[model samples]
Target chain A: MDNLVFERTKGLTKKEFSYCPGCTHGIIHRLVAEVLEELNVLDTAVGVASVGCSVINYEYFDCDMQQAAHGRAPAVATGIKRVNPENTVFTYQGDGDLAAIGTAEIIHAAHRNENISVMFVNNAIFGMTGGQMAPTTLPGQKTTTSQNGRDPYVVGMPIRMSEVLGQIPGAYYVERVSVHNPKHIIKAKKAIKKAFQNQIDGKGFSLVEFISTCPINWRMTPNDSLKWVEDSMIPYYPLGVVKDGDKND
Target chain B: MAKVLMKGNEAMALAAIKGGVDAFFGYPITPQNEIPEYLSRELPKLGKVFVQAESEVAAINMVYGAGGAGARVLTSSSSPGIALKQEGITYMAGSQIPGVIINVMRGGPGLGGIQPSQADYYQVTRGGGNGDYNCIVLAPENVQEAFDLVKESFDLADYYRNPVMIAADGLIGQMMAPVDIDKETPKLDLPEKDWATTGMKNRRTKENKDVDPNIIVSLSLVDTVLEEMNLVLQKKYTHMRENQQRYELINIEDAEIVIVAYGTSSRICRSAMEILKEEGIKVGMIRPITLWPFPEKAFAEIPESVKGLLTVEMSMGQMIDDVKISNNGKLPVGFYGRCGGVIPEPEEIVNAVKDFLGGLNG
Candidate 1:
């Protein structure tokens, strides 16, 4: 962790972090910054942020992050990435932002095979908006709005964005991982690194959906939240490469 | 008050350039196509950035990118075309990015027709995009306001750091008018942006670091944090509701009826009101220049003095609802209009106004 300390982020003083201690977005953000530091892509990289909790990600990542509305990170990322093709572009989006409001945008970007890597965080609830049922919300998970758990009969089943996006052309790589455990955290980091490398290599629309935890929103301790992700979120959203280049369904 | 001949769309583009905008990202749409044509030639010549984006999505996203970078930027499109831009618009609101978007509205409900129509009234004024965010929608009555608002919009956007929309109909884009901005374009060399990703290595980073750096962003997925963000926006919007209304009131005092109207319809309604004034019909008009801030209090006040009300628009009955809500049931309010390029004559409006008066008088 000492070697991984990003000098570019040295100026950032940790004001009491608002995020729950083990909530994975911090971990993912750390990993993204660490990789960028190692690759010296910090200055050349432009990040697009979607709606939801990640909106403030601009404050954390020591990169030129542009704020995009809802699911529009993909489209904005496309704009910066395509215009400055030499610059590496990525988007940090959450389930509701990517899977719900930005569904069409990310799907189209994947279809166009826009040279952008999407760092998708799936906490299975609209954690930023009082825990409403998200597009990736498990079928029976109780959220603030989905008081009776998400009723598939009323709200429909949670969407599998990785699988759905894998069908598009130019979607070079699509993987799903969890950040609920140290082992899972390492796997998530590797997947994120590969996605960034894919963009660096000019491969298009790579994504890594990190199954993260939302302890405060879930009304659980950070530890229990990680366990909830391991116990409940994974069964519905199994972590694995949904589609790699030339890989099967 | 003076008359000058200019194409509506071209005037709108000139207005943006005159406003000292830093960039124009656009794709072509009919009736409004002249804007892109003018920007393609003029924006770069003015030393502003102009990008003909790959699609409407890309065009709007380009605005998002530039706005995110804290540059004064904008994009333009028609109804069917603008629907494609909703996602980007929604994101702009959520991100609290300041920018301008122009909608030269055409027929819809599904690309229903391309001819001039007011069908997009509800779409533009009542949150055409998804989500709960309300964009400040400005409805221009003629080519002049269309141009003037483009300049005014940039200021409003920067002042509030929220997206400001100058929503006009196809008629406004197709029609010609004389416009004069007393203010000259500022002589200052373009001010540098603190957030724009201009690829210039000399710029200071957002964190005030001497070395170049990229910005980091993540929209909140944490409930408490998102709640705080939304509350901050709510306060901004409340301020807008109090201070953002721009409207005109004509002969509202001592009138039996007030016609609530905006955009092109308001212009036509003004003419109709003049004719009715000659005929001794006691009618007044409320022209809402800023439709989103919606001169509601002004409209509601009129109901106390006027006996009846009527709404003039190009849509089936979009602004009518707003008029009714503003009336607060203190008096009866009715609607009149044509859609999809069939302009309703003064006679039709006269008849509707007379009937509403008649119903109240009976």
Candidate 2:
């Protein structure tokens, strides 16, 4: 009857997303869900939701979930993966939750080469806290915290987590991808799939960093936010595979 | 099983194994390092998980994850490390996850010392973590009691779906004594942990056929929802208070003075009672085993002949507040303490009891 060309992924629950208008989090969530479903790991997947805009992601993923304290999702994921080795475990974290307060946790998780996946969303601002400056917030970008535009001398430069984690010997696969347009959206899904597949194949500590947009906090229209991500964010955080364990082997 | 001489930290480690711990996560801290060392060597042999986390903060969060995943998890640290873990501890409590934590106390306002101290009485009995939550704290007076309580803590944690703590002092962690590792602990009729996040593949309910994914979370953005959750937690705490009060009375019958103490201080009080008895003075003790529940019923058992109460501790009288509250001003209360890793002798406690009684008489 109907063409059946498109439908919702089974990895997602019936709960509707509550992201602000023009936020790319909904799109990223769809890509992750699609990848989990395509890989047939939805039922066995355990997602650790961190503090931030995505803290309530437990309601969106149709899989077992745990809500971790601020900046502790990596540690939580490590625990889940270590005990339930056969289960697929991953953490969903925003920049402030991963790069700032949880730096030690994420670094140590990588150092241990824990067999888990990580989905890091970088919108360059603390979306849930009403546009505070994030560790990933670009220098010269204005936010509630950096009213005079970011001064690298005053605070610090934006941290590129994918590149930082890629250098770690324990990290098996690391990549940075963006979701600004349809073409890049397809590429982002590919990287996300590989990250999950690496874990399915027993690879250690895979991570996919998504360059997402926060239109509400960016003080720009949804379309302008996408343009900003391409024009501003991409020049600083280039997209592509940062490391591949298979190639090293 | 036959008794074997075991160091306190090692004995507790073995007891945790015997208690059916599924995983151990911990960090290196003074006075409690032996615990993680023992588990790091032993757990792998038993095909159980053991992780030396980056810090006490990570270790406790790991405990939260494993416990949420339906594994019986344990972690251990000393005073300063335990302070670092308060955040994760509160999260576990709020999530109603089951975990066992061992706090082998050392002295501290900050980095106090490596020696024995009961200074953590307030931190353990009162909530060290945020929120309206209380961990079931067990204070053991000796190595054997420490072993037994540690083994039972897992069961208690699971039965209540709450965190449990073994509030041992440094003496309990470093001292050596004989312990029957196979000693039987009372079994609890625990409910099945169907809420654990073990996956959603086979989980099903008869009515729904397809079960919803189990979510382990403590975040309730709605104020009303959080208040309701707090009420539920309060009910659980009240039930714990009703059923879990434990204490031991020694020579309390027909005694003219009673002593309140727990852990290493209680052991000293026992020797003090014997010394007072030898001097023809009747002295007794109410040794509290459950610090949070605080054994108020034991106060009711105080002999009418008792003139006053003396609470002895290794710190500057942290447990005196509980003793006063339990005594309810029926008898005058006095405190005797030696702080900064100092241990009081039996003769000192004997003198303190006499002085307390003299004040009451005057």
Candidate 3:
């Protein structure tokens, strides 16, 4: 008899994603779903969706979901975690939502050591709003809002969020991972799993920042977006753990 | 329930505990700071959750999360702070999440003052946030009613599956009054919050079939779906308007002038009525308990002997618009108010009514 070697994770709904053809959000969503299914927390998990490309993610995640206003996901998640202390809570946010409008919410949640997991997706450009300049946009990278190639003299450099968040005493774990290739994708899943695990074990404020691809927004093909993430984004973002409270690694 | 003298803010804190609130998230602001201060000490003792959020914006979003999770949550702030909370309150309204928001209003056009004021009449009644929505706004004129209305707001919020607001002012929040914390504030018969994001652990069927998970969201990308959602919201508001209109009327049978006011301003109007009565002028008052469901019907009950209706407020004539609409041109509605943080004196209101009456007769 042939064994069913693989099947879709129950954490995901049957709906197809609305992401662009080559975006990494689908892959990241799959990984998060797989992690929740594997951890046996699918039924007990609650995901907070942010206002960006993934605002409609509530339709995809099988667990209970909430949609928050732009950049307010962290504060929303804090409310959920505090009220449902036994249930797992996580927020899925992007660069524009987290680094720009939601900076205070994220920093304060980390400062309070709120017991929640945050999946920070950094594509270095605003994807949903047609390639606007993001706080994490590289200094010389071009965007619709920053047409003159992101003037470093005026706009300043890309913000190193992982390092900044790692310095907060409440942030028990912080990491930056990339999904440009299979090898890095595996590493990224490991980091994401650890963040969820930390929350499950009652640890506070674990976040995994995924260096992702925005092919359409980047004005590149799917394959080229992966290559760009590897060649350019990784060099600036540095793929590794910035802080680990467990220090297991 | 033994009666005890308590400040409005402390009474609200005690009422929240008695009201079965599961959690509170708030930021410190003048006029309503006692809410958090009292909750921080009291909620922990009752084993309820309390978090003094870093900002009013965070506090309201926290309310969104807890309320979405099917918990009875609350938050309090003053004028400027409530303005910061508008974004989150709009989300709660859109998502149909149940929560209580206490806005102990102070003066404001920008950080106006911490003194008592009803200047937020436009902000509270007209939907301060960006959206087509109406929160069930309850205005309590005194400290005791502040406690009672706050307790009532939680149940009403859950019953309607919508946000309920207690729009008091600095005076009611700061002044001391007798209250019975153990008073039995009746609970509404609300449907089970099956949509609440409380873990779906028991939702699995005996045959191992999974129910579609609940989602508390407001974003509807499809035009048809969003329009339908808005229609659903409008229907809820219509129901609220029909059933939730409340007001207090006194001596309207033989009055020459009817004074329409609410909250702290109503108290001043009451004082003015007494002064007018002693002067042989028949004056009465209509104090609305629910501001958004603005007691429009009260105008129909106005006696024909009444020459005009006067709106007394602590702002520069914001509620006059509602007063005029409610009167429907049946009577000439005149507005008497003090701007900034100034409270109108009883004598001034009495004199305004005399002048209005004098102009009508002559």
Best by DockQ: 2
Give, for candidate 2 chain B, the lowest lDDT window spanning 10 residues: B202-211
User: DockQ, per-model, please?
Assistant: 0.21, 0.88, 0.86
What is the TM-score of each candidate's chain B when compared with the real chain B? 0.90, 0.98, 0.98
Candidate 2, B132-180: lDDT as tens digits: 8999999999999999999999999999999999999999999999999
Top candidate on lDDT is 2
TM-score of chain A of each: 0.92, 0.98, 0.98
RMSD of each: 7.2, 1.2, 1.3
How would you encode candidate 3's per-residue C-alpha lDDT over A122-182 as one tens digit per residue?
9999899899999899988989999978888998999988999999988999999987788
Per-residue lDDT tens digits of candidate 1, residues A1-249? 768843544322243345666677887887777777666677677777677877677666666767776677787876676546777788889999889877877887788787788899999889877888787888878898889888999989999889898877668899999877788878887888888887888767799988888887788998888788878888888899987773544
Q: What is the lDDT of residue B60 in candidate 1?
A: 89
If the candidates were sorted by their DockQ against the true structure, best first, what order would they fall in?
A: 2, 3, 1
Model 2's TM-score against the true structure: 0.99
Per-candidate TM equals 0.69, 0.99, 0.98
List, residue by residue over A85-133, the lDDT tens digit for candidate 2. 9889999999999999999999999989998989999999999999999
- Candidate 3, residues B105-168: lDDT per residue as tens digits? 9988898899988888888888679879889999999888888889888899999889998999
